[model samples]
Structures are given as structure tokens and as C-alpha cells.
Target chain A: MTTEDTPNHRTRVAAERRGKTRAKLLESALLVFAQKGAGAVIDDVIAHAGMARGSFYNYFRTNEELLAAVADEINDELLRAIDPVVLRCDDPAERIACGTRLLLHTVRRFPLYGGFMARLPFPAANSGLLGARFLARDVRLGVATRRFADIGWRVGADMLVGVMLSAACSTAREPLSPAYPDASARAMLRALGLDEVEAARLTALPLPAFELPPSSLLRRAQLLSVGRD
Target chain B: MTTEDTPNHRTRVAAERRGKTRAKLLESALLVFAQKGAGAVIDDVIAHAGMARGSFYNYFRTNEELLAAVADEINDELLRAIDPVVLRCDDPAERIACGTRLLLHTVRRFPLYGGFMARLPFPAANSGLLGARFLARDVRLGVATRRFADIGWRVGADMLVGVMLSAACSTAREPLSPAYPDASARAMLRALGLDEVEAARLTALPLPAFELPPSSLLRRAQLLSVGRD
Candidate 1:
């Protein structure tokens, strides 16, 4: 009876270990997909994650499902990172400044995810798969637009969103040189009808350092290695 | 002696007629090229201009040279059209409004040229042969950017030029529905930091009808007939 129970306990422990492995695979997959793009093959992802090829199918039924999971993971992470900064201030200008800073920081940290986010259009029709990632930013902008409208400025949310998104996309593609963020941020504020003094004040604030994970470097190296092979 | 001098006068008159025909062909080429894009074949342009295939070579040494001429003609025409408007206003906002109104009118009149203008990038590098049609707008925006900078706004002229060029391109492509020019124009004004009340007033003004010359219509009809043949 003791020998039979020991065999069962070993089987249970193996299953638990497999579950943990799958979770780590998914996390690694998100980093890889964000860096290389959603179109990357499952084999590449499995290799990057340091997992067996057979184990990938156990967690993700297909690459499509895996991409969906990545989008969800990124969306949740971005919301958690940005929501607090957006909600920190009552003043609209302050909100914009904080939001801009938070976004820039996030982009710098997760450069690949940042590029993906900027490139993704405002999923108006296909909301099921890609919409989850865009929802937080859209909602935040919608609220900010309302606040601006309430303050007697008849600005359209889509226009503001388009401008900010374009700015962010441009910023993500290039490194933030000394002249860039200050010049670009001031231009954005001026474009939004902020006075010169207000624009200067917002532009003067130092941008924060981005905190990227080691997994990102690992994923990129994996991609380069795979391409070579 | 009178008959001998008459032949000389007649020869001179015939030469002048040939020169005028060449000039007309070049002008028509601009209209056709701007509509069809720079990549348009010589046969298409000849068909549009109601000229024989062989006649095109009489005016232009080659298709490339014709494209260069088209660019030159457009640059001259665009400058002539907008210079007055820019000179009329001292305030940057007012100047921008005047320039916008003029551009809107020009785009409406020659929708094809507007299409060509839309494709050309700002501060066009290859203005001599491949990209001359793009120079006028670049100069116009250069003046506007310098003016804005003179007022102490350190806005990057290139970025603002890109934004305005994008706006112009969109305006040219879409039909003027009730929701269009007003919404887009307002967005443009907001983006440029123009006064809201002033922009609203400008938007309220009636847009004029776009007029085309009889020869232009005749040429278009002839081209259509040839297409059916």
C-alpha cells in the first residue's frame, strides 16, 4: 500500500511541474512574440522559451491562441503600469504629462511591446483578439477627451488619439536623443493648444528610465540566433 | 517683293504656332501627370491631351523631361496661387488660414494635381527631375515654419509640415461630404494651435465651386472615347 501511494505521489508531482513549465513558456512566448512579431513560428517560440517542441501544444492549441494570450498579457501589464499614473492628478494638463511620461517609460522598458501597441490601429471591428490590448489606452483617452471638452475645448478624441499615437509610434522607432523628447513633447503640447508657459513646464520635467526585463534580451538573441541557423 | 516678305512672315507665324502647341502640350502633361501619377505612360498622357503619339516627343525630349516640366509648371502655378495669400496676413494663424483656404480651393479645382501633390514628400530632395512638383509646397511650409519659429515656438518645422501635408492628402482624396472638411479642418486648426473661435469662423465660410476649362473637358472626353475604342 505504501509503495502504490508513492507512485501516485510522484505522478502528481510531475503534473504540477509540467503546469509550472507551461506558465513559464507562455510568459516567455509573450516576450518573444512582442519582440519578433505575432507571425513568428511556434517552433521559434518553444526554442526561445527553452521548452520542448511537444510541450508548446500542451499549453497553446495553436499559434493564434498563443498570440491572443500574448495580447492579453501585454494589455493587462500596460493597464497596471499606466492606470495609476493617469489617475494620479486631477488637473488635465498634469494628467496628460503623467500619462505621457508613463507611456514613454513603458515603451522604453518593453520596446517591442511598445512598437506593437503603437502600430495596432484602434480595433473598431475586430475586437475579440487584438481589441483587449487597445481598450485601456482608448478608454483613458476617451476620458481625457471628455475632460478637455468639459473645459470648453471642442477637441475630438480620435484626433488627439491619432496625434498621440503617431507621436508615440515615431518615438518608439527611434532612440530618445537629447533634442527629441523635449522638442517633440513641446510640439505635442502646443498642438493641443497648451500655452507656451504650460508647454514649457510640461516639457521641462525629466523623463524616467525604462525598466526592461532580461527576458527581452534573451528573446532578441534567440531570434537572431534562429535567423542565423 | 511683298510676296517674298509674306513667305518670311508666314514662316515666322508657323514657328510661333508650333511653339504654342509645344507649350500647350507641356501644360496638359502637368494636368495628366498629376492626375495619373509620375509613373503614367506617355501614351496615356498623349491620349489625355488630345495629341498624336509622335507629337509628344516634339515638346519633350523624353518622358522623364516631360515629368520635369510638369513639376516646374506646377511649382510656378502653386507659388502664383498661394504667394498672394501668404503675403496678405501678418499673423501666423491668419496666414495659415489663408494658405489653407487657397490650398483647399486649388485641390477642389484640380483634384488630379492635388493627388500628385499628396504623394510628394516635403522639402523634396530630387526637385530637378524626379520630384520637382514637390518643391513649391515645401517652400510654402518652410516659410510658415520660419514664421512660427520667429514667434518663439521651437516647433520642428519638418514634423509640422508632415502633419499638414498628411491633412492635405486626406482632404484631397475624400469627397467633400458634410462631415468632412468641417471636421478635418477643425482638427487641423486644433493641431496647429490656431484660435478655436477664428477656426470656427473660417469653417463657416462657404466653399466656392471648382471650375474647369472647356479644353480640359474636351481633352478628358476625347481620352474616354479613345479608351472605348
Candidate 2:
């Protein structure tokens, strides 16, 4: 009998199910790591996910690898959420405002993942390994930032990143604080050269789902992957 | 001699000596702490200053007190370095630029002390025993920030404080890199509705020292006494 027609096909389907279980394990790792921080142990992750001890090694080689994967996942989600808004708007001020609102919304929705990555205790960016990783990420954002700078937006990409990271960290630490979101949105708008009235108007509007032009998503994905490498 | 003359003479002489020794201990502590974080032992500070252990104790009751005093000294230097330029500039953008340039120069001059205070793992503006002591020194600088905000600068006082602290920390970590200082000054200027060219012009000028206006020194001295209380 053909293998596809045999009863053992159920076993093959079960293996596929196990693959999904492994993905679920990694997702659980991200959630737990975000909530508890990178200092969390494998056992704690497994306990939180209600998974078997033996099953972890089947998915990840070590805790470090798992943490790295978690970082990648969080980075991907962040880009997924905000990149469209950044790329869609041609006006620098409006682009920044939309991006800021989307970022605030994303942080509120996935507080743990966003917060943990924002507070990652990597070495100084000038240090070889850490710096390379940081610069890789910087290059992608620099593309958008340089676009603004070319058209009279004078702030450097580093300040933009620093301000965003600071805002994200503050929001993560005190999500329930009413003042944080308003202050953060206002700060970002001001940084982008929007007047107070305009900034407030932009901030108060509901953020719309941004649609990417043809090939934009693919290019961004490639750039993001390069950053990860 | 009369009893009144005897009392006054002894009191003045003792006060002079006490002030001299206190200044010496503070200088020593700044050097030691910068070289080896706040965790360095009291013996190290005393040895570095070539002072006797007994003399160190006579000046500071504990290491925590010594560190607090060191923080105060650094803050005072920072305030003295930037206040004149900041207060003299009527334009918000010019004020931010001048303030940033003065800060950068101070960090460059005393990289270690700047790094120690900037990256020290203490809360920003706390009210706990140590926090209260630290915040008392910070309040002077905080007032200047509020003044900037009062002049229609878009950045809030807290955000300005955060930016300043972040700039100091980044500069301390990477003094040779121009990215941080340039980005910081630009961000501050942008928040005040000024472009980078104007900000750069103001930052290029030499900064002045902070001196009390007229009789304000008496009030400052009273505030210092209140902090002690």
C-alpha cells in the first residue's frame, strides 16, 4: 500500500501535531520571558506552559537559543505592527504621529513582549557583538529617519530611537498610569515638529491599519532579517 | 580675652577646618567612586585621598552618606556649569543648546564622575531616605527644567530630565562618539520648535558659570540648611 493510504498516516499527522506543540512552546516562552524577564529558567517556562520537561529540548537547543528566538519573535511583531504606518504616510509629521499611535497601541496590547525587549540589558552599542546587533537595527530605522532628515526633519535617528525606547519603557512599567500614554504621544509628536494643537489632534484620532505598497513588506522583512543576523 | 570673643574665635577656626576637610573628602570620593563604582569600599576612598580612616569617619557617618555627598557635589558642579548659559538665553532653543553644550563639556572634563552618577542604579527622583537626599540636590536642576517648560517648550520637565540623564549616560559610556551629544541637542531643540542649525549655533558659543543673582545666595544657603534638616 502507498504510504499516503496506509493507517500509519495517523502517526505522520501526530508528528505534525508535535511540530505545532513545539511552536506553542516557543510562544509560551515569549510570554513568560516578557512577564518575568530574561532571568527566568527553563523549568519556570515549562511550568507556565504546562509542557513536559523532555519536550523542551526537542524544540530548542538551550535556554539562550530559546531567549534569542523570543527576541526575534518580539522584534517581528513590533515591525509587523508599526512598519506599515511608517511607510504609508508621505508626510513626515503625519507619519511620525501615526507611527507613535500604533506603537502605543501595540505596547498596550502586548505589554510584556514590548516591555522586555525595550529593557534588554545588552552591553554598550560600541562593544563589538552588541554594537553590531544594535547598528543592524539602527540601519533599518535610519532609512526612514534619513528620509525625514532629507526633507528638513533635523533630529538624528539615534535620538528618535532613544526617545521611543524611553517612552516604551515608561509605559511598560506603569501601564495603568493615565498620564503616561498622553505624555508619550505628545513627546513623540513634538519631536517630529508637529504643533501642540496638531499633535493633540493626531494623537486623539484612531490609528488606522496601514496598507503597504507592492514589495514594501518584502523589502522590510529582508531588512529586518538582516538586522537579526 | 572676653568670653564672647573666645567663643566666636574658636567657632570660626573650627568651621574653616571642617569645611576644608569636607571638601577634600568629597574630592577623594569622586575620584574613587568614578574609578570603581559606588560599591568601592570606604578604605579605598581614604587611601586614595591619603587621609586617615578616622578622618574619613569624622567627615561622613557611613559610606551611604559619603556617596550621597559625592552625588551632591557632582550635581552642584553640573548646576554651576550650566545655569548661567541657560538663564541668560531668552530663547528656549538657545537655552537648550547652551545647556547641552555645557553638559557635554562637563562630562568630557570629568568622565568618570559623570558616568558614575549617570549610570548609578538609583531611582531618578525618589523619597526614600537615600532618595530624599539625592532628590534634594536634583531639585535645583529640576527647577531650571520647569522654567524651560514654562516658556512654552513642548518637552515636559520630566521628559527633559530624562533626556538630560540619558544624554549624560550615553556620553559617559562613549565620549569619543559624536552621535549621542548631537542627537541629544537636536532632540531638545526640536522639542522647542527650533531647527538644528539654530541649535548648533547656540551650542558653539562658550558657556558661563552659575553665580547667584544679587542676594539669592542667602536664600540658597537657607535651602541647603533646610535640606540638612
Candidate 3:
């Protein structure tokens, strides 16, 4: 047999195919959840994916499991997309504003992702994933540096997340003013104890370019949304 | 014919029965929406109500109609409960604070209502009903009197509604610290341009007793929740 037909190559090819199938399922699941909220069943997902029931069961056993997997994928992709810019901000307040604006912009760019997020209950949307790590990290830093008032991280994160998620939910339904993200960030900062001037200035700072690799969930959601349509 | 069997008596009895059936359908819809989010179908609602399909169509033609009817009922009940206390407070800032706290308390006391609200997307939660009239009135008064920063009523309403709804959503899933509602209101006031001291003092004012009439939606939801259990 040729080198390409070796057992090692065969196993690698099979694994690659399996990975592709899993990713496709995730993409389809996102679309389904976006359209139907958390109540979507496995049949809906499999139909959206054009896959048989057996193939879906191989990837996810229940709607909850599939939703959990989708949340993880979103966190990972979002973390990747925003980490670079967030890490570059020296001031915790700036990082907070930047993160808020970037998230809103990302949601606006991918209405499907926003729709999925809009349908999520607050706890499901914020718990142990999206807000848990990234926002929590920034909040801790802001508190330690005295950039934020001494409110505990939980309260601080709640204020920021509440405004951002609500705004994101609004954007999902219709186009918001271009100024909405900045205004929302400013309000969050003000709630965190930044003076009006400082809050306005930070939110008004030029946002660095937001880049999502083609492999990102936001990108996949965009493509999948079009394909499903 | 006997007096009880007269045509007018029969007509009045039929109307009362129809009203009772419609109310039962709404309560069931609340439970179904709470459990399944907005994606719940007519079959699920009818099943929850333990009624036949024909009965459901007589009340609501679609899930959207059922949700709309539920929302209107909630708004009417909430307005009645809060209007007395809200009118007693003359200060626009105080009205905002009182409104925020009352909404949270209402949600916490009636988790079925909270769950239904928690499942709602932001626009669906706030648009044309919940935030449209009562909160909008307070916001406009606050803005006109310069109690709130001169942000347009839309932005002002957005800040208040965003924080309140987010807090309500969180309260739906779990019990929060007793201070959560006050803390949320204080942050909202701050976002609306109140000083921290004033914001705190306003929220700390002894909230007037909240009373939902025995016939209120909150009471019905409470009873319905026990019945469903």
C-alpha cells in the first residue's frame, strides 16, 4: 500500500472528518437556538444540520448538553477574539469599556449570535462562561487598582453585564443607533463609580480594530445563517 | 321560565364563564412560557391548561397573541399595585427608585411570574407595555425636572429598564441578597446622573408596602404555580 494508505493516515483522516461533523453540528445548533430559544429539541437541531438522529446522538445526548457545548464554543471564540485588545489596555476602566463595546459590535455584526444571546435567560447567558471569566477578571483588576469603587466584583460585574446584555438583547431585535454601545459602556462605567467626564472619555476613545478569524463562531454563525436561509 | 333561566341571566352567566376560561388559559400560558421560553407552542399551553385544542383557539389564536395578552394583564396589575405608592412620592428620583424596588419585589414574591419574565427577550420584556407607560412617565418627569441627566427619555428608560429587567431575570433563578434590589436601584440612579449619596438615600427610604390585590396576576400566578405542582 502507498504511504497515504497507511493506518496512521487513515486514523488521522477519520478523526479530521469527525471533528468537521462536530463543528457542523455546533453551527447548526447555534442557528436553531437562535431561532427557537432554549426550547429547541434534538429533532430541530438534526433537521437543521441535515443529519440523522443517530449522528446527532453521537455528538450530544440532550438539548441541555448541546446548549452547554454551544455556550463553551461561544466563550472560547469570544475570548480569542477579544483577548488581544483587552490585554493591551493598561487601565482596567478602559478594558471594561473596550470589552463592552467589542461585545456589542460583535453581536451587531452577527445577528444570529445576538439572537441566540437575546433568547438566553440571564443566568444561562452569564453563568460560568461568558461573564464568569473575562468580565470577572477585569472587574477584579479594576477593584485592586482603585480604578473602580470598592463595590465587590459581583455587584460591579452585575452592573456592567446587566446593561450590556440588555443592550445586546435590544440589538438583536432591530438596528440600534451606532452610539448605543458607547452610551451603554459609559453608563456601566458611571455605575461603577467613574465620574461622568472620565466615563465619557473612556467610552469615546477610539476602539481598536476588532478581528475575528474565519474560524471563529461569529464567522461560522454568519455563514450558517446564510446557508440555512 | 324561572328567573334564573331568563335570557339576560343566561347571557351574564355565559360571559362570566368565558372570562374564567380565558383567565385560566392565560395562567397556563404563563406557566408554559416560564418553562419553555417564548418558543412554547399552542399544544404545550393547552396541555398545561388540561384543555382541549378547541378551547385554546377560542381564547388565543397564536402563541404571540397569548403572550401579548399575558403582558397586558401583567402591566395592568403592576400599574395598579404601584401607582398608589408611586404617586405618593413626588420626587422623580424617588419614583424611579421606588419603581425599581417594587418590580424586583413583585418578581421575587411570585417566581412563576419571574420565570415567565426571565424567559422573555429584552424587547419582548420591555416594549410597549412594561417600560412603555409607567417607567416612561417617571423618566420623562425626571428628565423634565432635571432630576435625571438630560439624556433623552429613550436612553434614560433604557438604563432603568435594562438594570431592572436584568436584576429581575437574576432574581427569577435564585434568591439574591436582600440588598440586591436596592443596590441595583442605586446603580441605576448613578447611571442616570444622581450622586452616590443621594442615590443611596433614595433607595434606602423605607419602601411603602407593596400590595397586589387578591385578584391580581401575581396572586393568580402564585396559585397557579401551586396548582401545577
Considering every candidate listed, which one attains the maximal TM-score? 3
- Per-residue CA lDDT of candidate 2, range B1-229, in tens? 9765798888998999998778667766666665565347789988977889998888899876776676665565446545655667665455556666556555444455444554243232111211122222233343355532222221243345445544445545556354445555555555554444654565556556543333222223323334544
Q: Each prediction's Cα lDDT score?
A: 0.49, 0.51, 0.76
Error of 1 at B63 (Å): 34
Off by over 4 Å in 2: A1-15, A52-54, A122-155, A176-183, A192-206, A210-229, B1-183, B192-205, B208-229
The per-prediction CA RMSD against the true structure, in angstroms, equals 11.9, 11.7, 4.0
lDDT of 3 by residue, B40-140 (tens): 88899889888999878888887777887887788788877787788898998898889888887776677777677776655566664343256778889
Q: Which is the better candidate, 1 or 3, if ranked by DockQ?
A: 3
Query: What's the CA error at residue A180 for candidate 1, in Å?
Result: 4.1
Pairs that collide in candidate 3 are: none
C-alpha lDDT (0 to 100) for residue A111 of candidate 2: 49
Best by DockQ: 3
Measured by lDDT, the strongest candidate is 3
User: Would candidate 1 be rated incorrect, acceptable, medium or high by CAPRI criteria?
Assistant: incorrect
Task: Please state the error at residue B92 of candidate 3 in Å.
Answer: 4.0
Superposition TM-score, candidate 3 onto the true structure: 0.81
